[model samples]
Target: MVQRIDVECKNESYPIFIGELPQKLEFEGSVLVVTNSKVAGIHLRTLLQCIYAKECFVCVLEDGEEYKNIQSVQRILETAFIHKLDRQSTMIAFGGGVVGDIVGFAAGIFMRGISFVQIPTTLLAQVDASIGGKTAINNKFGKNLIGLFHQPKAVYVNPFFLGTLSHREKSSGIAEIIKMAVMFDKDFFEWLSMQNLQGSSLLEAIMRAILIKKEVVVKDELERGVRMALNYGHTFGHVIEKETQYKQYLHGEAVSMGMIMANRLAVQLGYLSVDEEFRIQKILEKNDLPIYYKIPSMESFYQSLFLDKKNENHQIRFILPHNIGRFIPCTHLSKAEIMRTLEEFCDD
Candidate 1:
């Protein structure tokens, strides 16, 4: 059965179709399907078979976070140019978050902005990255520093693709679900703490997380206010990704640790109780998500916090749990207070 959620934006509204990839995705104009080599090997043929466009093209990129750069974006543009795709054409992002971001960015800049669809295969992309209309590529300074808010025309999330995901990939996706629960739904959090994260239970969690995200995005499409709450664990998570050069941990794994760090700060500020903090960590651990990261240098890590895109006015905004089921975007904390929290994560 296919479930649908509509994401209403100021200029347009699109549907998130949750189910199998339709047998045919009819498009009036030419189509460019961008993905990575890894995904191509696994599911490219299946995706191509579903496109009923006037003309279709494929651009398969290298598979890895390190390759999410301007070069990759250029490669995609080159393919579009070679294929002579016009503004009327639509680009299909047929992979995980990395492919979706790269393809969305490419489609956004192509002809100064065109239409694209997201076919997010991994759980991470399906629930969070693919829905937000936030497209970006990483640079030397930080993750997602170069990109724009280019919303896709639609998003197709096929749980069938989840069958091919490695155990680690599924665990990574659960971390995002956990973040949604910790920030907006205590009842969901409690429910998640008891589930084993398999089959029907996993699909239910994805739907719940997507619903929460849809509500937040519709309210603040540009992330001017309450939408900032969605960054709950990303500020620190991006730093972790940068520190390790996006090699050691998946984005969600970094986020898992970041959530723990954020919770630590929230507990310090008396916003979240010790029991609540423990509960959050326990749920994360239950899904095999990492909950700890040894800070190499508190000072350096503190300095890097400013590089995050979320920081502004020379202040790093932190998304912290206001106990369970609520969040607060904090920019008023002194450097000393943040440094103290960083020190706690340092190795003895």
Candidate 2:
């Protein structure tokens, strides 16, 4: 069964089609499908068969988080230029989050902004990254530090792609699904805690997560207000990704650890109870998500917090869970308080 969710933003509105890949994807103009070597080797042909554009081309880059940089974006642009794609062309992001981000950023700047569609192959991209218009490439300084808000024309989330993901990759996507529940839906959180997340249950979870994000994005497309809450674990998760140079853990794995650290802080701040914190951690652990990371340096980690995009006025902001299913963006905590939390995670 196919489920369609419409996301209406202030600047643009699009539909997210979930279930099976359409038999035919017709485009009026030329099309460029951006993907990675890993994804191309597996699912490229399936996607290629579905396209019926005036001109279709493919550009496959190296697959890995380390390659999510300006160089990759340049490669995508180079392909578009070589193919003579114009303002009327559309780009298709046919892989995972890194692929989607690169393709979206390139599409956003191509001819001063063209159009792109997301065919996110990985579970992580389908539920979280694919829905948001936030596109970016990482730099030496941080993750997603360079890019813009380039909304896709539409998003096609085919569950068939999930079957190809490794167990670890699936867990990575589950982390984001859990994030949505923890921040906005108490019943969903309770429901997730009980289920094993397979078959129909997983599909239901994906639809619910997309709907939750859609409601928030429509209200604050530019992330000027309540939308910031969506970065619940991202503030710390991005730091973990950067520190490890995006090698050690998947995006969702880093987020899993980030949530643990954030929950500890919430418990200390009296916003979440100890039992609630345990429940959150238990759910993550149940999904085989990592809940711990030894801090390399407390001082360095604290300084890195300021580099997160969510920070304002040099004060690091945190999205702390309020008793589960509710969240508040906090910026009033002192450095000493944050340092203490970091100290708790340091390995002896």
Candidate 3:
């Protein structure tokens, strides 16, 4: 069965359809397909078949997070301007997270907002990025430092695209898959632990991962409170991305390591059981993820945490794990405690 998830927004809601992507879907007005060169090489034919618009165009960007910045976003804007895209015009974000992030943000700011559709090709995008309306680009300041929350008109998840992913990329996506399982559905986590994690089973797990994230996003579209829990692995993940200058790790790979560090920190804070901590590590290690990195100091990360849009002030917020299916928005840790956490991470 193709499961459908609905996410609420201020003006309206959107549908996330999971299963094999359909060859065609009916639509109105002009439609533009925004994709990356790598993805277009693989699926442009099928995408062209699926789009139903009076006029259709394709905008291809180079793949990679490094390209998901103001420069790229401007290209999309230029394309829209060249086409004289109107309010009735629709755009499809037709690739992984980077494509979705840039294109979705394009939909938000272009002529004050146009209809955007998400055709997520990567496992990470399918399970998480494509569903949420949050679109953004990275700057020298930090990752996703420039962005907006403009929800897609629809999100289509197709497991067929999984066939093209490399083993390393597949493993990277599994990290986010496992993260969703661990943060919102303990039963789902257990199910994931049993899977062989290669073909259809991996795809099924990916959809299940989306299910977990969808439920939370529906409740908190703007991330006022509960939805922030979806960031369980991202606190340290962001810092890791910064430290590596976004060159060393994929988003999901960094997140895999981030979640492990968060789970371990939870144990130190007297929340997680040692057994649970070990289980988390085992899951990451089984997928070949590293859970630790040495930093000269927490000075930059600490500063970044405060600057994080999610935080109110110098006090940083973290979505700490309470159990397999629960997390709490905690800002109780003093800077001293944070420094100690960094110290211990370095020592380990």
TM-score of each: 0.98, 0.99, 0.94
User: Could you give the candidate ranking by TM-score, starting with the highest?
Assistant: 2, 1, 3
Residue 278 in model 3: shift from native, Å? 1.0
Judged by TM-score relative to the true structure, which candidate is superior, 2 or 3?
2
Per-residue lDDT of 250 in model 2: 95
Give per-candidate clash totals: 0, 0, 0
* Cα RMSD, each candidate: 0.9, 0.8, 1.8
Clashing pairs in 2: none
How well is each residue in 262-334 modelled by candidate 3, as lDDT tens digits? 8877877877788988887888788777777666566776777665667766668877778776777778688
lDDT of 2 by residue, 1-348 (tens): 778888987777899999888889999999999999999999999999999998999999999888899999999999999999999999999988999998999999998999999999988899899987999999888889999998999999999999989999999999999999999999999999999997889988988988998898888888888888888888889999999999999999999999999998998899999999999999999999999989999888898888888888899999999999999889979998998789899975
Error of 2 at 303 (Å): 0.8
What tens-digit string does per-residue lDDT give for candidate 1 at 62-166? 987888899999999999999999999999998889999999999999999999999998999999989979999998889999999999999999999999999
lDDT of 2 at 122: 86
Q: What TM-score, to 2 decimals, does candidate 1 have?
A: 0.98
